[model samples]
Target: MNIGFFNGEFIDINKAVIPIDERGHQFGDGVYEVVKTYHSVPLLLDEHLERFEKSATAIHIRLPYKKAELKSIIVEGIERAGLENAEVYFQVTRGIAPRNHLFPDVPPSFTLTVKPARKIAERNYESGVQTIIVEDDRWAKCHIKSLNLLPNILAKQNAVNSGNFEAIYEKDGFIAEGTSSNVFVVKNAVLYTTPLTSNILPGITREAILQIAKEEGIESKEERFTKDFLMNADEAFISSTSVEVLPIRTVDGQIIGSGNPGEMTKKLHQLFKGLC
Candidate 1:
């Protein structure tokens, strides 16, 4: 049976339980990181852990273990769960305590789960995906990957109800990013993405793509882009741990790049797969 790690101990998911007084349960005071693995090898693990540490530190949530020890735990969890080409989820919560809006007094709780890899829909990968635009109503500290994601959840739900795969968040008519991924626009063979700011999550896959583009001699820039720019771009895509490199075929019912995957998108997808 697959194993899960809860508070530094391995247990079956069904048997793993937490107190109702857990601070994460009452206040959603937690942070998380998702790392992708290919062929039993974790990709950009150090970076993920770094972000994890930063997120924890941002909220004053202390990580129970050091980064190196946590990495070993994640690797062990992956192996124990028999995961190869999969996703590993790590989260830390403020732990159980009396109900309060403030930080908890108890130690933090850590959990890790590994699941079998699941690729995006075949059609999405083969042709492209569609995204709907929604206002960015999330908290201002979007740079920290926190677990309090009701806004993102609602936006994603709205997109799903509209038969779309993702939500591209708009702030003041500008495209911030997909609810849970980084947004990219390609025009005239140049890649444009939002700068790492307080408005969006700094994605690990996004960083890898930038490096890949550099090595492949592709021009890239970090600048603010409006929704109009996204609607008019020759190509667009999103990157995340769950969805590696996904082409955005449509934005708000308007066609993007012939309403199909663009040449640049295909090249990037191919290059991304080559890393595996």
Candidate 2:
């Protein structure tokens, strides 16, 4: 069984415990981050931790440990889990209390879990994935990476139920993001993604891609584009801890860029893999 860091101890997943009164369980008062690893080496850990701290502060939740200490714990957890490549899921939730909507007068609880890295299939990554556009009706605090994700869950499941890989969320004809990933498009030889706003999640992979673009001399723009623009793009892709630079061949059954992965996407995919 996978070992999990719950409360303060590393224990079997089956034995890991959480009080039913935990605010995360009752009111979803928490934030989380997912960090990707490759061949046992954590990637972009500092970036992820920076975001983790930001998320904690955004919700007024106090982290139980400092960033350095948490980093050690995450490294230890990865070692104990025996994962050469994996995704680490870490969260901090306001501690347990009696059933109530008010904040608990206690320190927040921290939990870190490691799982086998979920790698996209070779065919899916090569041939590209599919996405469906759904209305963006998520909470305004999406930039916080909070635990409240029912709206995203429903939207993502709706796409999955239709055999799609992701749900590109849109608001008033403009694309905000995916239910769980950052959406981007390539048009006229330039990369376009949503700007940093409360309307979208701040994705670590997205940042890494921007850095890669800068280093590789590829132009990028953080500008909001409409769903119609996405539909007309030469290529589209989504980024997340789990799905890194995942190409989208079709959106809502409409073919994207000759119904295959575009050239720029393949080049970026190769560049990201090289980074790993």
Candidate 3:
């Protein structure tokens, strides 16, 4: 019974299909955004949509509809899903055309899908999660939320194969981010994370955490830190729309600090939950 918005129409998920020649499918030419709903309301929707538009613009893909129209479609699809807590995923791609690397003259195609939200295991929050550091092999434009996610997928799969919760991507020993989240470390009671650059996505949740920290008088810095610093930090965590704030207890089998979620991490997690 789930409903989805596909190419300007709302239809049953089963009936929503894309043409084989669609650029998103054929060339991975698309941008996407995932918004999580709490009490049937999307959190930081405006920020997410703004980032979506920026991503599309970065890749020269024009959105088929304006932000207001897209927001309406998201609301309609979420209502059809009938889930108080859900994840709304939407994407825009260059329309279907003959297989070619060159830009096509056709209009763009946009789709929205809503589904029940996935909750993280309580154990992960209580006992904290383990992760491994992997070499970042993604392209230069990691800030764009494009469909080209093969590198991220492989890194995440590597984490899964190793029986870990996530993969922390590092470029030349400097931590960039997680496979699907932003990375943060606490040292001497100061929270530090990567700078806003082309190396990492400017996560909405990450921004919220920093804002909360500022309001709470918690010291934070946006600067790159090396693997040695991360391994020896007092605490570490990852943030994203889905995970919110997840504690990192260990990395590459090396225990971080006392191998437990730090006081700052817990405080920030509570603040983030309140916002949600």
Candidate 4:
């Protein structure tokens, strides 16, 4: 079963509760976080909440609930969902108001939903996924996980239409990140990913992967790389809360490495799943 929460109440998932003037629905005025669960427990929720607060602050929208209350609500949502594995999505919006460009004086609106997690096919994990390099045409502050995702949606749809699974964004001749994931490269046994900057979301799974590499004595670097560097890398993958770690087989239709998932990629993903 799935669950829905709005304002201070939990309602039917299919209920028409939001008003027409809701800011999140009207202007995408919100910041959200998604947490994945395994064995009926939400993973790294504290870290996600920290980021969620940061995103809300960046957008000048103060959250209505404290950290403890937010966590309680999330756990309750998972229990109501009754799924071992779930995706918990929550957002804080600027609240309902009359049609105007200025900020409203109403209280912020908080909405949440818990649904069964989406699983990628085993074949994809084994064979790796296809990707394309697209110019980064989004706003400069991509670090915030805000609700304005028009550019991301467009790029992802374009990738799917072109028979690819993900879209990697290249900003100023260097790899920024994926439309919805963090880009990574393994070259000569060293893991390389973009550093924490204003143009990319600091993914929770990405930080987990880096910590895993450190614990496993695997060499890693947080540095920018070009498309050519990624194309020639021995292994490549994308990371996110939803995807965890997914291998990339090609870029712009060009085969990466031997056109297969590399040993390190598989090893890292195995180690990552251990955390779950």
Candidate 5:
């Protein structure tokens, strides 16, 4: 039976519940982290927890437990699930309260769920996937991994309707990021991606890939690029905790480079897997 952690207790998944007036449900007031596990151990767990704390602080939500306590809770949930590979999702909300926009006096609500990880299709990694450009409609504080994701949901659905794997968001003609990943472009054998700003989430996988690039002696830059640059680049890819290094062969029906996963992307993927 699946198990989850909620309200400081481990319980059967079906028995877990959050109050109706919980701020996360009523006002989307929460921050979350998704840690992918390998061999029953969470990969980059420390980095994920650090980012989670930063996200909560950005939204003024005080986490109920310390990082060490939260880590123990996650491990316990994973042990209960008994899965070798899984995705551990944990979140902290402003807490249960009367329906109001103001911050409540009660402690924050912490919840965690562990489930089997879904592997991306090998064909996608081999032949790459198509994506469409969508106008970014999220709020200014995109850096925070908040529960407010209406715009991202709409854009992701739009990508699905367009027969694409993901949506690359653009703000004022500048490529920002993907609906759930970070965008990177290869131009003249150099890598370029958006810098850490309010326009995009500072993805943990994105940072890992950059570190790999540096270690592998691959040239990289964290500067923003225009739509034309993205469309005309030699190659492109998106990265996330789940997706890892997903190559983008086409964008809005325009072929990228040779319309295949680039050499640099394949190398980075192998290096990333080594780290995992």
Candidate 6:
């Protein structure tokens, strides 16, 4: 019962609704957000919507619908899908245009789809997941959730091919983030992660963990740390809208902490799930 939305109407998820000359299809000229729902309610929807609008504006693409209209679309799409847990993905693109490098004077195209959320393995959370470190090769504007993700996918595929769960990006000898998640390390009971910058996406789950840490009085710092620091941390993990707070067990084949899901990682994830 997955649902798809394009232009102005809902359709089957498999429908080929986008035109061949669509700017998004041609040049990845768009910004997208993925919202996860639990018990038929999207979590942190308002924050996601705010970030979505900011990303579209950053890329100079005017969204076809207002915030209210977009919310209605999402809610209806979720209902149509009829799934208690769903992954709602939506994007605003620069619209259809002939082959050209310059911007076209056409309206933006908005597309959305709602489907069952992908489930990560439960054992991975219990044992934690392995990761490989890769050099950050993406553009400088990583803060904007743009559709250009070639480098990210490449690194991610490399990690998967190497039997790792995720790829952590190291820029200038320090950890920037994971290919699709934010990196965090707990050292001597203090949490640390890369600060907000043009180098990493401001992850919703990462922010929630930080806020939860503040509420629980767990010390946290939003500052860059070296790869060596991460490798030797007491505990480490990655966070995203999908993974929530998945623990990291290894970096480059070296065991992290006791090579198990740390107590704090478990507690933080338990608290994060409470929000859902």
Give each model's whole-structure lDDT: 0.89, 0.88, 0.93, 0.95, 0.92, 0.95
Candidate 6 lDDT over 1-276, as tens digits, reads 899999999998898888999998999999999999999999999999999999999988888999999999999999999999999999999999896999999999999999999999999999999999999999999999999999999999999999999999999998999999999999999999999999999998889999999999999999989999999999999999999999999999999999999999999999999999
lDDT tens readout by residue for model 1, 56-174 = 99999989999889989988988888877788888999998888887757899998888887677878977788899898998899999998999999999999999899999988777
Candidate 6 clashes between residue pairs 3 or more apart in a chain or in different chains: none
Off by over 4 Å in 3: none
How high is each candidate's TM-score? 0.97, 0.97, 0.98, 0.99, 0.98, 0.99
The regions of model 1 sitting more than 4 angstroms off are none
Look at candidate 6 and tell me the lDDT of residue 170: 94
Q: What shift in Å separates residue 95 of candidate 3 from its native position after superposition?
A: 1.1
Per residue, candidate 2 scores C-alpha lDDT tens digits across 128-216 of: 88899998888888899999999999998999999998999988678999998998899999999999999998898899888888898
Kindly give the number of clashing pairs for every candidate.
0, 1, 0, 0, 0, 0
The candidate, 2 or 3, that scores higher on TM-score is: 3
> lDDT by residue for model 3 over 1-276, one digit each (tens)?
356888988887888398889999999999999999999999999999999999999999888898898889999888888999999999999889999999999999998899888899999998789999999999999999989999999999989899899999999879999999999999999999999999999999999999999999999999989999999999999999999999998999999989988999999999999987
TM-score of 4: 0.99
Model 4, range 167-221, lDDT digits (tens) per residue? 9999999999999999889999999999999999999999999999999999999
For model 5 the local lDDT of residue 88 reads 93
Error of 5 at 47 (Å): 0.7
> Under the 3 Å rule for N, CA and C atoms, how many clashes does model 4 have?
0
- RMSD for all candidates, in order, please: 1.1, 1.1, 0.9, 0.7, 0.9, 0.6
| Candidate 6 RMSD to the correct structure | 0.6
